[model samples]
Target: MMNICIKTVLLIFLSQIPVCFSYAEFKTDCSVPQSLNTKMILFSVDEEYSLYSPEVIGLIEFHFKEKSFINNVIQSQYVFPGNYDYQVIDKDLAIISIKEVVGNLVSKYQILLVCISDIQGYFIYSLEHGERMPNVHRDTGLYILR
Candidate 1:
């Protein structure tokens, strides 16, 4: 009887090992994105693209030169995924920008892309609009998208 009790206890403990490991895996999978200085949580590409209107996507793709940049944006967690303003600078140039407010402070980030060419694009982040250039020297904070 004692042998059977020991075997049951061991089985229960072994079964819980996978559960613990799974929880750890889940936490890592949903982990936040990283920035150079500030803490920012950019949205997942799939979420951003899906949230964007079809027309907006077309407009962005139309002037965005770097196709890979779009893929990178979609795959990267560099900007918050939320409402944005799109503007057409030229026939083949466009910008997508967003503003995020934390407490009473607001920050802006923009993506400049070419519509018809395969040129490289840029991701810009700043505490104020037209106040500072986008670089790795800003104090960004935790970005959470649900």
Candidate 2:
């Protein structure tokens, strides 16, 4: 009798697990990497102010169940509204470095890069214009060493 009761209880517990989550399938819309130096930023529109910037951060590795891969968190940064920074002319890029992380073993990702593009957005407030001005946007690439 005890054995029958235990089995019945265990069966009930296992069955309840499915009702906990109704979703049957899990899917991700992000694209996977196909080649070197050619990664499509997940959401270009949403990547303006990412902390990773272009150069300072590269070789970004994501920790999956057992493996990891590189990814770009910040596609662009260092821009002013009225005066956008153009790389061809300015020759400066933002480089992102990962100082540290609390959980290194779990996600072991350390970012270290320097922006080679000219410092465009590093500006002081203008006395004549209180409103934020426009800065040019230039295509910048992150450099990661092997």
Candidate 3:
């Protein structure tokens, strides 16, 4: 009778061993990818400006071609009434200059390379003073900035 009891306990423990391993494996798989995405979001903010010009805000978007990652298209837009100018530094970098007229004071806000992408094609926001911003994902290889 003691032999039978010991066999039963051993069988139960052995059966649970696989369950524990499977649970641990599943947890690691899910956690690894989730943590990577979170880190990407946290590292995306490149700058934070406490005293930013309130006159004009710029909106920019980058569209990456499918399969041909080297070829990208850029589109720029402005929020509020202002004279804006932009220059593409490269495929993934740009400089935006905004001129706002407020009460005879012409304020020029230079937003340099507000966003950039990695070699693996991940988009990150370039913020001032390492400010944290909302996580933004690409839509069909298009990244939009506001």
Candidate 4:
């Protein structure tokens, strides 16, 4: 009876959460390497200042001979809106910061990259800072690391 009750409660809790799908395609022919030279890309879907919140996407890439590390962002309850930027603070770490203007409000969001090796060859993380943003950000917990 206890086992059945636990399973029923687990099913009920999970049922309330939304499902999200992710689609990724790799077009590169490069082979996986033990180490990489790292590069990052951060951008918003739009620059328009309106009542709406735009989507922010971050990409961290690791290349052959490039060494990189990662760190976690300081936990904040305040959500920031805007663009993203980064600086390599150490041989294996980089800090990414966000600042943008939406209407009269200047918003900010940030993340730190600390190191971990995944099977995919590099570490990637994404954060969607708004309630109405795409479900993919929330479902994936915005992090993909190799």
Candidate 5:
């Protein structure tokens, strides 16, 4: 009975070893590329492209040219001008810090993008406090490389 109990305990402890190391920590800072021309479309929560009728919230485009960063956000038929800074955490992962300026209002966002391939990726955006949109929450979206 003593040996059986010890073996059972050991089995339980070993079963948890993989769970502790399976999660990958998100990279914070690294050398990121300065050239970007990517367009991504944001979908409302609970929707994906496979639904055949995903509800799109907005479309965003990022451009880095001539040492300048240019960003465009289109929502509700209005285009907002913006700029961003980015850091590459890995060869296929990046964090984009953006500030969108609209007349007298400014909104901030931090985006985490994981590139699955050259033409497609997944992303999530966190909206900073004091945004122009009152009921807005954190949104996730997909990247369509341009």
Candidate 6:
């Protein structure tokens, strides 16, 4: 009888292992254009593609080109996703710059890809504050979608 009880207890404990592991996995979904990898959560962000004044997009690409990882992220090829309901600033409509001046260029447009992931988990993590791994041992590169 005691042997049977011990076997039953062990069986229950073993059965719970997978559940425990699943919780530890800490997986989440990466937004549009972003693909979750073992290292970074990469997704695209949208902005006006102006050749005359490329400052807006330049700034964003410049940062990533540096390839700096913290919390949990890495470097990769970036791309635009789709058209979005993006707007520049909290203002009116359409910004047509003559030369170098950034103000309200975005009026519900382009969708860019942004990919990011956790170095430790190899799973998609939430970009929010609490969604990060409990104890991130390494630097995770968390980039904002422009």
The candidate maximizing lDDT is: 5
List lDDT for all candidates, in order.
0.33, 0.26, 0.31, 0.36, 0.57, 0.26
**TM-score computed on alpha carbons, candidate 6:** 0.18
Clashes of each: 11, 30, 6, 13, 0, 28
Highest-scoring model, TM-score: 5
Error of 2 at 38 (Å): 3.3
Candidate 4: residue 45 lDDT (0-100):
29
Candidate 1, position 94, lDDT? 49
Task: Arrange candidates, best TM-score first.
Answer: 5, 3, 4, 1, 6, 2
**Candidate 3 clash pair list:** 46-127, 47-127, 47-128, 47-129, 48-128, 48-129
RMSD of each: 16.7, 18.4, 16.0, 14.3, 8.0, 17.8
Name model 1 segments beyond 4 Å from true: 1-79, 103-105, 115-146
TM-score, structure 2 vs. true: 0.18
CA lDDT of 42 in candidate 1? 36
lDDT per residue as tens, model 6, 1-146? 45555556766677753222333245344333222122233322223433322222221222122222222112334422212122222111111111111243322212222223222111111221112233111122224433
Looking at model 1, which ten-residue stretch has the lowest summed lDDT?
A: 54-63
How high is the lDDT of residue 116 in model 2? 25
Q: For residues 52-135, write the lDDT of model 5, one tens digit per residue.
A: 223345575655543235555555455555777667777678887777776777777777877666666777767774344442
Worst 10 residues of 2 by lDDT: 80-89
lDDT of 4 by residue, 26-107 (tens): 2233332223335322221222333332332233222112332232222322333334455665444455554546566543
Better of 2 and 6 by TM-score: 6
lDDT per residue for candidate 3 within 1-146, as digits (tens), equals: 45555556766677754222222333211111111111111112213333332212223332212211111112223222334455565444544444545455454444444233332222322223211222211111223331
Backbone clash tally (model 4):
13
1-146 per-residue lDDT for model 1 (tens digits): 45555556766677743222222333212211111122222321212322121111211121122111221133233332233555665444445565544455455656543322222322322323423333222221222221
Q: After TM-score superposition, what is the CA distance of residue 84 in candidate 3 from its true location, in Å?
A: 1.3
